[model samples]
Target: MNGARGKRRFLLALCALAALLFGALGVWQVELPCQTLDLIERVDARVHAPSGPIPPRSSWPRINAKSDEYRHVLVRGRFLHDRETLVDALTERGAGFWVITPLRAAEGPILINRGFVPRGRASPSSREAGQVAGEVTVTGLLRLTEPGGRFLRPNDPAGNRWYSRDVAAIARARGLPGAAPFFIDADASANPGGLPVGGLTSYRLRKRLLDVALVIMTSPVTVPLTILGALLVRITMGAPVLFVQSRTGVSGQPFRMYKLRTMRPLAPSEALQATSAGDVRITRVGAWLRRFRIDELPQLLNVLKADMS
Candidate 1:
């Protein structure tokens, strides 16, 4: 009888442990969205408007990070047609190649991303299509030049395949001289057909700061409170206590972001849509999750996993 009692206790303990873990998972999922929102709010405040005379090469924001270097700068130089780097680039506006060319500015040879040209127009010959020539005044944010290459794929200098904006690598590859430490995002200028353009730089510090703030809020304390809330919802309801969906992150990368299950599952293979307050699909529990941001806690795990990139 004692042995049987002990066995029962062991099984109960195991069940309790399982319950604890799932409860924690659910809560963590809920807290993430709120945290991320906060982070982004904070980063947006300071990321734009430039940060003084631009930090030296060492202090510039690293690859995939922000830097104050892009503060307003003025440079007047002639475009050096000989060496140009066509980089694979995607912008808030669209996807295309950035025409990064050396400009023989009086200050030095600063790299310039002339603008976005579609796939067909990525070649130097495209410069003839509508090139900005002569001693032009270029004014815009100075983004710290990306060096080395992109994650995973190393830059191939031989065949002229570049994944990132590593200025040093480009200089080495093209055997160019006096390359500036940074690159300028040229401001919008007049062009024909009113398309395939440059100088459409939009500055928004408010949005970026919010993103950074949200990410930071997903720290330890807030995550626990979220888990407690998930436990209450689960005990009152039944199965399907969590919801997961895929989202596109930086660099067009996709990852599954979790939330408290807020909507009714459609046909098993159905696609998800953005949730609206008035949508009939949202459950009472899900509505609460959305309101208090209990549904977004799972993304903390994603951030920890480095999946946000």
Candidate 2:
């Protein structure tokens, strides 16, 4: 009788633990939207706060996404129209490109996302009127560098194809001296021609909610499985159980795509070939992971990071 009573108590405790665990998970998932909304509100507050002078060159080292991103700032400089680079973008008006022009500020050159232009009006000549020359004051929100290429397509400097507005890369490609570490998104003030529409930002709540749902539902199952898989991969294959590659995201933006390493490290030349069923390059554990689609579980993190859905 005592043994049976003890068994019942053990079962009840197990059930209670599971209920608590699942309940916690559900609460966390539900709070995601609220957390995101709060963040957006904070950013909006910063953006609307009284404009301040652009951070000087000496302060560049300390500036980061947390401290400076989306902060409204004032800058006066000459626009380097000749060196402007167009980054692929998608906005409410449909597919377009951001005209990124460098502003020759006193402290240093600062890249400015002048505005968005539809595919038809991408060329400078097409939107010549809005291309203001000479020194001008620009007040807008500062944005951090978006390094790497979007999705599967990496930034191709040689071809002049850029997906993300990577400040360092753009400065290097444009041969600009003393370029600032960040860029500025121009405000909604009307330009001469209205070709490159300023002050356009993209946010899709429905898509974000859907992505959150996917991460929440799959994480409980995938998290532990991924950990076990990592251990197995390490034992069978060696260290470095994961691999990260740059891939394009929404609106041709670039983001890092994460995945479990599924094959032996290969030479640059050998890595180009597609894997066959009997290929020796793939490790035994990698083969199993690929077969069961277990290798893709880590991408749930990318979804959480808003890089993928």
Candidate 3:
């Protein structure tokens, strides 16, 4: 009788622990959507805040994506019209070219995406009125360097065809070694003839009701499974269970992507190697998680946050 009573108590305690774990998981899942909305609101506020002076030369070394990206800034410089590069862009006004001109600022050369121009007026001569020769003041948002090309289309410097505004590559191609590490997206303030439309930065909604429905139906099973997978990764791979990587999102925007850590750290060159099913860097638990697609469960949070679809 005592043995059966002890067994009953043991089972009850196990059930209680499981309930608490799942309860906490459910609360976390609910908080995720709220947190995502809060983040978006905060970023929107930052992007629209009163304009500030451009960071000086000394501050350039310290500037980073987390602190300075999308910052509204005012800069005084002269446009190097001869060195401008036109990058292909698709905007609300339709397909166009981004007029990226090098501005000779006090600190160094700064690339200003003056704005977008329709294909018909892509040449500097076509929009000559807007091309101010002397000193000019530009108000715009500071954007980070977009390395590599956009998606599968790489920037062909030799062909003078650029799919993305890769600052360093553009500088190298234009022979402007002193160009700033970042670029500025000029504000909606009008150009001389209004040829290139400024102030066109806008975010479009990509989420649909069907997407929310799918998340709702699958989350119950996936959430707890994710927790279990996290625990397993912690025990097997040790610290840093989650790996975050910068990924290009819709409209060529950059966003962080999160996933379960699945491989051992490697040097930069080695890390670039392609991996297959039997890659040796993959952890034992990671291999199992990857096999069942359990590693991607955390990205559901990204989808909830509207960073991904």
Candidate 4:
């Protein structure tokens, strides 16, 4: 009787533990949407406001990311493209570099993220047609300076390989001592030759959070299915259970989409070619996953971070 009672207690304890975990998870999940909505409301108001003069130098010290970032502003200045820094960036077009140029204005010099340019077009001479010489009025969203590099990697100014747009670091390196602490992302206006593409930043973050919440709330079922499918792919396909490729999203923006690995990696020349009905690269297991629509399971995580609804 004691043994049976102990067994019953053990099962009850296990059930209680699971209930506790689920309760905690539910609370966190519920709070995330609320936080996301609050963030969107605050930022959307600032973004939709009319373009105004940039914060004066006196307010520079008080500038911060919380309230000031993403504010629309206008600056009239001459772009000093010669000292422009090309920071590595990954956009809808593909992996490329951002053209960070300093604009000489009356208030002071400020960095302007001109836009994304592929490696071949990164050279200033390549896009000389778009380089406006005289004082031009530029309007866009302001962004806080990124410091300490990205993803635990430090900015290598010595080698001219910058990972983040650290305002102070970039200014000191470019010899612009009084450069503004913030930079502006140029609007999606087409340049003469359309070399560096602008206006890639998405403001639809509200939809993004809801989309992610949808994915997370279904985690109990999706997570297990994903793990099972991944294991099956790994076992059948040797290695590389996931395939990543760049695809265009809403508003003609490029984003990397994810899916279960169902085929071999394509060669550079063959990348433009699409997979057909009887493509040899698609493995037997991959075909089954595709038939059951299991290959798309990985895309749910994309909704979590890629601002794709």
For candidate 3, what is the lDDT? Answer: 0.81
Candidate scoring better on lDDT of 1 and 3: 3
Query: Against the hidden reference, what TM-scores do the models get?
Result: 0.57, 0.63, 0.60, 0.66
Query: What TM-score should be assigned to candidate 1?
Result: 0.57
Worst 10 residues of 1 by lDDT: 201-210
- Which candidate would rank higher by TM-score, 2 or 3? 2
- Candidate 2 has a TM-score of 0.63
Clash count in backbone of candidate 4: 1
Note the residue pairs that clash in candidate 4: 92-254
Go through the candidates in order and give each one's C-alpha lDDT: 0.63, 0.81, 0.81, 0.80
Local error of candidate 2 at residue 166 (angstroms):
0.4
Candidate 3 residues lying further than 4 Å off, grouped into runs, are 1-35, 202-309
- Model 1 Cα displacement at 261 (Å)? 12
Residues 179-281 of candidate 4 have per-residue lDDT tens digits of 9999998878887788678776543334554576587668666765666677678657757888888776542346678889987666798677788998888
Q: Which residue ranges in model 2 land beyond 4 Å of their true spot? A: 1-38, 202-249, 252-303, 307-309
Q: How many Å off is the CA of 54 in candidate 2? A: 1.1
